[model samples]
Target: MSDPFDLLVIGGGINGAGIARDAAGRGLRVLLCERGDLAEHTSSASTKLIHGGLRYLEQYEFRLVREALAERERLMRLAPHIVWPLRFVLPYDAGLRPAWMLRLGLFLYDHLTRLKTLPGSTSLRLDRDAAGAPLQKRLTRGFAYSDCWVEDSRLVVLNALDAAERGAQIRTRTTVESARRDEGAWTVTLYDSDKRRRESVRARVVVNAAGPWVGETLLRTLSVEARPKVRLVKGSHIVVRRLYEGDQAYILQQPDRRIVFAIPYERDFTLIGTTDVAHEGGPGPVVISAQETRYLCACINRSFERQIGPDDVVWSFSGLRPLYDDDAAANASAVTRDYVLELDTDGPPVLSVFGGKITTYRRLAEHALDRLGPHLPGLKPAWTGTAPLPGGDMDGADFERFLARLVAERPFLPAATARRLARAYGTRLEHLLGDARALSDLGETFGGDLSAREVDYLVRHEWARTPDDILWRRSKLGLRSGRADVARLGRALANPSADPGAQRP
Candidate 1:
């Protein structure tokens, strides 16, 4: 309700939500505004890993890798529900890099940081190991390593939720139209895209965590003098029918020395991605091009015997990586995923972030807050490293045991629904599925495993204002639901007040 906040973060992506949560926890009065849903632009489109980029060893980015590796464990401990450890099966190919080099990389990735909850990397013979069963029999050897799989969009929402819990205001569908220094504070005009309403906010500092839209948010929206140059790299993904038998994810090494992942997703499908190409246009409207579709399908077809064609592709999406324009002259994959903070301090400070991975958002937030230290007189020390994210209070963040106990407690919920709720809500699964005796009590099924009750919770609690926000971002139902289900959800969310819990102030 205040015109001026102590801090105003521009984007609602992972970086923005992280900064907002950090700053708010440090006792800064904060306000976060997103033009669309949280992670609508880029954050959710990530490969959804929270591991040290083993490939970055070639770039000699030891610092970034170590920090990312450490953060991966920390985040898994913080949000055990949305973030969990996953084993990546790096299938070996004779055409790709040698086994010794891959081993060296895995060795470094394992020893880069102090060990914690996750296990170390190991070698596997494809002929004997279960992880290799689905792969083309030509693959004889592989390396199994640990990484984290996160509900990328939920990471943003949980951070935003934690920020709000720490007394920050999160405004979705709100865009920062203009920001100007007035006296010693920032006068920011935020426009609501849905209501066509305008409001003003003031902040001693502002953060432009606008991901792919970072440059545009500074130049077009805020009219700031300082602009951090960012290179937009387009990456795309395709969802296909489950190709493998187990929950293990595949990391395919391509001839171009690039890596692609085939991760088990949404129970019945596998998620394969992504091709890196330079993109110089709008980020919001980015889509999977025909070439990208072919590229992904070809990569899978080459690796698997089943031959996943375009017809088997059920869903596809694209995102632009707003990389900090480092001096690398090659393609998007070579561009550093490391983030850079550009502070525009002509009057009221503006900290703009560029090019960060979902793996390192927490540390990125601490670093961003550190940059704002001179502006905020009495800011507290960083505390996110130890604090558990909202529902991640499980014993030592071991989600498997927690899920087992949850299912034991409520045998009524189907195994699939229980696992989904437990994964989505952690210890708070009790709250979401409270007193529901049967599937009917979970409310109307919206196709897939999505239910009306979960939709209501997201709308009332997580600020999901649109159907796609619920279907795609908040939940992965988009991969499972049909077009008719989406259309129905659209009509329902368009007038969400009709839902039992959709009313929000």
Candidate 2:
């Protein structure tokens, strides 16, 4: 048998990528395998907010709130290009939550974590602000607070990229067929979905962050009975034409007490969502149901000046949260977003992660490694907090300044193109753009602003192996790019020699 890896991470979502990145950075030999492309599941299908779950304050989850809030501050610095500060406008209605209670909650949110960069919350006169102009007349006043927005999928990719650069092996479109414990190590058999090849590797530890299939991975793949059950809660989101004109998002409180967000997306569309409902069936592609679309539209119509219906929904997505079954709350919305790490040290040590959100993923990874301390030899101390992610190591770590430099360096490129590349690739755009000074030098354009140069870069550096991987996950240009563009992009990817620089990692 070959030398065993120090750790093996299953799943490539934010949680798994964060763990692999953390472990690898500490100089541990790591290998992360995913059944599909990175963030092909719940990690990408998020409300894309990095903030303390303000509503969780009602649940009295003070610890979770504080931790998430702190992480929010850290991430804004860590990935400023992909993560930026945003203001959320919460319109007040005396019926849902009283003025006094809302004030107390916002006060707690502002003070729960030390604020160095983000602004604190304050009551606003909605009638005077543009935020109020888009709202219903009844909502005359509200509060505005700070949080961070993320390109959910890109966050996962950057983590995996940083991990790989730090000496971890990332294998996408690969599945662990079986994992059998032998002495102090695990013999894992992996199947490459695309190559139709099978191989086995040895690992001292297996970290299961398979998300919705955590139980299934333990039971079926590891041939062990699943422990610490998970409750699958399905969250759905809907997109529509821009509902209002503003960068500020809305946090509307429903009569049922659940909160929904309406945020700007893709510069031209409004993203609204999400409904919490218990999932009934087994593993499969989750989509927003007609009922969910209607519910979201109704929720938006309740707050926005321009009312919308289900028919107005342009796109929708859904993801299942593999929450650790606490059984403490009967309602899915009330279930804990905090994570639980269970380390089975009986024989071969296996760690399973249950119930976590994107905001707390970094902390989750740190805690996950801490659990394996006794099992790992010479494990390095935690260090991810102070380190910058891939393409995020900009001088001053300022996105706008770095963007100005990119456009300044490549004067031939369009301003919008440079901005998009900077947002998507950050410092790495230089590497992708190479010496190409003109649009013609960047190579053929495949619908929208996507170029062959960028496609080749994704294939070489990022694990973008298919058209869907390029059009949808790597970039959301698929929403605007036509079917013909997709077909052409597929053809472009197939002609490997076309670019000549597209080298697979």
Candidate 3:
């Protein structure tokens, strides 16, 4: 523990985790610390689409859209199990934007990149198309285009897993109490919340990837003076019962000009959301406000034949976006989703990451390392783009084929359980489901298809310390698991030492 780390990344969100993975793979000793579970905030509370931001095109963010579009395909390849193709229907309204303008934007989106696996945008007649059945009769014409859906929280966890695999230290429930530059290196003091102990680590450099708390991390955690450099925008979403029967989703443009997405969720629910409201306070557990809920319901009701009210909302979550304050845009929705990386070379370098979206995290990490390259003499070249994440190196990145093989090997699991495991773990499932011939080997059912075996795997390897981690983050089984089931799982995690094989360290 006395040895100095080459890099210490101070955040467990997508950007921080992605940088740690990239840095570790580049032959640098890395450490990543999070005060809570990974993706427990902005990274998890997303619209859950790996999109090119079709709306941004209106603001002339062509470069951002282009890069995001390219990475959308790369993510599909790099994490096929969690990210997949989704078609979106944008119903035309004469009152909103003219159809000709919509057609032009769609054309630009299609031609933005040279490489794409999805089909081009095409016109749809609501009366003739299955995607149109849920919409009102008045919305007869629309355009359908391509995007990808992601298991947002799992993506963050996978990045940390890959970083850990590449010899980086990932400490969850650890906070950076203070960091100060001394002589030519950074002395970072971390507080282990689990052990209630403090430990100091030496690192050649520090990365402040603390998303919403970027400013606070600088002034309070690192003891540095900085201005109001970031804009805290709050985005919220609502989950309700399944709104439609089809695989397709809808992107409805409201009278306010803000677009809302109503996509299929976790089998039995419809995921509708995302209102961009300005956040004026500190970061914590964000919830959808009454106004946001009403706004979202109104947005959906504009097109869907089935009307909904606030009471229909089964669940809702909110997160704050740490957008770099460019001061050019006034509205939260109009603010750029692009990121800004600041490297302070005043002493031993400390890199600060600000204003980034999930779509471009990989590229951001590469750029981060490139900025710090001068300080670290022997850092290796960029390698994450061509590399596959943990369990992502399947044949042609074909999740369905890999899933079929997994189920074929373990016929004990029900089809639903096997598919869920495959989607969550991919190739990692083989090692997780080790040496069990039937259902009995899985041990202790905790409701749904959640078994003792999966819990052990999550604890031993993936850092599941609570029932909520397993039920909500790693797998969205919380949406289905009953109260009794959750309580039992909670007790199991509370005493990890009870199981002989469960990890203690």
Candidate 4:
């Protein structure tokens, strides 16, 4: 490109990727830069639910709830492969909120979404229903509700991929060292994280979708006068062996009126989590504290007959929520889950986003683009709702049905391996596998549905620049694969010239 034509986005999280995808689709030449792997920050570290947070109703946030509800359905329609319907069993506790109050909240949640394929919320009898099988024989009444689950990191990648396919430049391992606005455009110098090299670009408008780093990106890098305050609330999750026997997930009530989720994850593991506490430090490399692990373990042990100690915890991860600093005196859990867009329109326009979720990213992008309308008068009207994300073009967002078609054609492949491929790549599985015949044709197996061919495909198409990018983010094969297997893939990838796909120019 001659220069950064129209816009330069500073973050590769969901908000930044979504904004870049939207702007590029609207005929603006754009560039998106990420300091690390995409979604390595707060965007990937989410509760992974695409719902109109039922608890937000307690704060009287009807507008945010309604908008998120609408986006939930919209995302389900667009990316059914990665985003699917999940039922959460909320066991009732008489001491906490009364059954009637819980019923009222459930009633609003049911009606908030324009009920389509997702089932409405219903009251359940813990003794009578299968959802209550894993719980202790305490408390009789409960509520089972529906929400959507998403692959958070993949969502960011898909947006970035879509943006790239539309002629937008996407640079991973690239950090914005400094940005300044000249007469009508932004002058930005970026340092590559891997190569330790610097490159520069100039654009008419700049977007700071840096999530938790939004404040620092403005204050330290851009040297802006006013920085939008954002609260960094830490939330953590622990992966334990699957506790329940069924597909349903449990939403447990804590002593402090907070909630925890124990959902089925990657076949054999149960992903449980999320304690909201005030965090003062930076967002990078935030790990689950020992206290957080204990809090989560205690929360799980309180409700279920199957007690899970620290030993039961196989893996743990934590993320910081860059929430908009709404003046709330209560705890971090009580802080608002809403997002805000701060625009600097004085000289060259700069739009900074604070506090958003994976559920509402599309709408957030559309709204962000709308805020920039005054600057880019020739921008196209907002249209992400009607467009399908990359690899989500399958009919009706139906993965199973699409998998059946893939299997029919590739009958030689194992059913489990094929299903895994179908879920991860959707209709693109055929393109990834590409006329391969037997198990041996897939090259070497790295255990748990991972193969050499799949690794090659990811490095070629999905931006797998690192081992963690392949093992954890692109897929959860690392949870099952052994150390030796990971080392094998690492050694193979290190010899870039020997690899079939080594970032060909």
Candidate 5:
């Protein structure tokens, strides 16, 4: 083996990617391995909100809420292109949570964090307000609160990109098959699926941030005999043709005492989610069940003036949340979302992470590094909070001003295409455009405004090897792309030399 790395992170989800970025920025040699494309699982399948869990107040998870609320502000500053403020309307129901209770919860949510970039909560006159136009006539009063929306998967890929730029080796489509401790270090065996080959490397410390597979990675891959503390809770979501005309989202309370969100998505769809059902089966590929589809549809149908059934669901997805099992929750929905980090120092130190949400990922990385500080001496202090991600170096985090400038300079780009590029790449749009003065200069249109130049940029800088990597995660152009577009993209990827913009060393 070559020189041992200071840290080896197993998993490419948000937590893992964040850790790798943090460790690499601290001048430690780091390696991050993922079994599939980055954020292919839970990280990408989030409700995509960067809010303090307003409901967690009922469970008394104050610290988690406070940290998440603060991080929400920091992330907006750090990645202005992909993270922005969102308003949520919570319609009142006399049969459900009392009005005073909702007010109290929103009050705590607004004050929990010191940073206040977004507006505070206020009572809404649903009958008079435009936000109330879509709600059922029976719902006369509601509340409006502030949260932030994120391009979830893109966040993961950007973290990995930043980590790689900071000298961390990010190996996607590579699995850590096994790891063994030898002489105060870990001998890790990785299987690269694309190459169909196995390789071994050494690392002083290993971090297990494998979302749903954390338990299996420890028991099977690492051969650790500790009892797994993770409880698998499956959350599912559905997408349909736009349910409303506004950018605002709705948070609906169900009779079961659980809450669901219906948010405007992708410009043409309304995203409704998230049923928390216990996942009895072991972690693998998960799909939204018929029951879940009905549950979500019913959730929207109950509150919206326009009703929808399962047939209206254009797309659906499910992901398993590996929550830290507190063992006292009455049901899956009640389980604590707080994370627990366990350090096993039997030989080489291995830290296993359990149950963290996307909002608190940065803090989780900081805490993980703090836990490993003793074993790995001379570590730098936390700095991710202040630093910007790869393309988020815009002044004052002013995304709109940056976008206006991009459009002004590249008037050749269609307004929609320019906006999409600015959102996806921020200041990096110049790298992709590269002196192009016309639409044809982008090369090879593949529907959904996706072009050959963009694809090449993704492949070269973002580690995009497949079309799905571009369509779904890198950008949600998949919603607009068809089979023909996918086939064309696949063909383009198959022949790298065909791309005129391919960098020649």
Candidate 6:
């Protein structure tokens, strides 16, 4: 029987985290509950781009593209550590999209947003350029455009961290068992998995940003029945050993009219992906199928000089997108990438978020608040666009300069480790490193430069409870960690009291 909250956000994915952060900053008493770890689902499984969705233009989704493009610049400023500019090369083919069509699309992508900061698109002579080294010899002409890369899971956690700092309660591994409107408010029953206990609380408004589970949450959790407005589309990705020798990514157009991306990944690997297949099952555990693996390999083999097969895939993941059912396009790839917010006023106000991508999450939050403003009084104006996310307060949003400064300050750190820490924690590295002058001061290492000091920091501040939380989401060092490393880390987390000398900052 805690004090009633002003807002209860049920989901820890990007949208829910963003809404919680925005609402809390606006002075609302907010509570965010997630059934699993934050971003354990769709948010972390994204293609990890903060782009305008260049393909969405073909579907006539101009507003979505424009808003996303604008948000790209804002995110780069707000989280320069995790979001940065990336160049993508789209190679030309004799039979696929005409060169004129490619140029037109690039032109529109370049001009859609007035706040463009990245370099504009340009036609490339792939045969003579370094970008052409790995591509097929026939792919001579192409176009290069600008987008941005994001540490998707970290982005979600940072939003939740900001929300907590602003006085919002973020409860991970907590599930909303049921919610019912009672006397102009919502009585929510939450089940904390770790504690195996249930508690009841009240909320003035409920925001269902449950991502793929929006429909399930409505029917099973909230006892609301209505025609489903969400279309479940599953997208998957694969990671492999390094494929090329450049920082730029490639956008290969398939004969089926869909495009796939091959981007430089973790220093030693390449990331490829994203197949859109209509998901018929419930939103549960999903993995890349054999068909999908082959399809992706075939797509890559069609354009690249370095051919690969399913055997080359080192890792793969899949996630479901609960798209707003426009009910016009039957094909999953043709479905709109836009979002829809449905507000139900029959009882106490409840807002259900239908479809949204990682790029436009901030705007979605702003719009969610705007939609709820009439019911909730004394809310502050939108301010997230100008605010820096946690650890994103570097001067001028210049990550390189910040990295150089960090290296100069801590010359003891290895160059690679310094860059990784700089990119992951930004200005917060000062706090993490705290009074320490050497690597030994950071405590025991668990491979991949992961230290006990950093582990304690995550446990104390980031709501990290397990090895997977530290390995996969908070950082992607899991790719470099081995079984022994994971086991060691798990033991350390289970018995934190054993590390008597572990630094706590």
Could you say which candidate leads in lDDT?
6
Estimate the TM-score for candidate 3. Answer: 0.98
Residue runs of model 3 more than 4 Å from their true location after superposition: 498-505
Instruction: Output the worst ten-in-a-row residue range by lDDT, candidate 3.
Output: 496-505
lDDT of each: 0.85, 0.89, 0.89, 0.85, 0.92, 0.92
> TM-scores, in order shown?
0.95, 0.98, 0.98, 0.97, 0.98, 0.98
lDDT of 1 by residue, 1-505 (tens): 4656889898999999999999999999998988888888788888877779888998898999999998987887889898887888998899789999999999999998895678888999998998878889999898999898898888888889889888988888888888788899888888988778997778889898888888888887767756458999998999888897888998888888788889998888899987898997776668888888988888887777778788888888888899999776577788988889998888888889998889899999999999999999999999999998877999978898998998888887779878888888888666677788777888888787788778778877788877788888888877667889988887877774754333222
lDDT head-to-head 5 vs 6, winner: 6
lDDT of 4 by residue, 1-505 (tens): 3655688899998999999999999999998889988898787788888888888898898989999989888888888788889999999976898889889998998887674578888989999888888888996789999898888888888898888888788888899999887767788898987787997788888999998899999888887888468989999999998898998988888879898999999889899988898998876679998999999999998899899888888988889889999776468988888889999877888899999778888989999999998898699988788888876899877877888888898898788777777777776676678778877788887767688888888777776877789888888888988998888888877866544333321
Pairs that collide in candidate 4 are none
Instruction: Please list the residue runs of candidate 6 whose C-alpha ends up more than 4 Å from where it truly belongs after superposition.
Output: 496-505
In terms of TM-score, which candidate is stronger, 2 or 4? 2
Which residue pairs overlap in candidate 1's backbone? 3-202, 4-202, 5-202
TM-score, model 5 to reference: 0.98
Error of 5 at 114 (Å): 1.8
Q: Write the per-residue lDDT of candidate 5 for residues 1-505, one digit (tens) a residue.
A: 7999999999999999999999999989999999998999999889999989999999999999999999999999999999989999999988999999999999999998889889999999999999999999999999999999999998998899888888899888899999999998999999999778999999999999999999999999998889999999999999999999988999999999999999999889999989999999999879999999999999988999999999998888889999999889989988999999999999999999999999999999999999999999889989999998877999899999998898888899989898889889887778889989999999889997998899889887777878888898899888899999999899988894743222111
Check candidate 2 and list the clashing pairs. Answer: none
lDDT of each residue in 251-351, candidate 3, tens digit only: 99999999999999998999998999999988777888899999999999999999999999988889999999988888999888998998877787878
lDDT of 3 at 356: 83
Tell me how many residue pairs clash in candidate 3. Answer: 0
Tell me the tens digit of each residue's lDDT in model 2 across 334-430.
9998899988776788899999999999999999999998899899999999898878888888999999888888998888788889999888887
Residues 1-505, model 6: lDDT tens digits: 7778999999999999999999999999999999998999899889999999999989889999999999999999999999999999999998999999889999999998899889999999999999999999999999899999999999998999899989999998899999999999999999999789999999999999999999999888888877769899989999999999989999999999999999999999999989999999998879999999999999999999999999999889899999999789979999888999999898988899999999999999999999999988999999999999999999999999999998998998999999999999999888789988999999999998999889888887888889999999999899999999999999998894743222123
User: Predicted candidate 2: what Cα RMSD to the true structure?
Assistant: 1.5
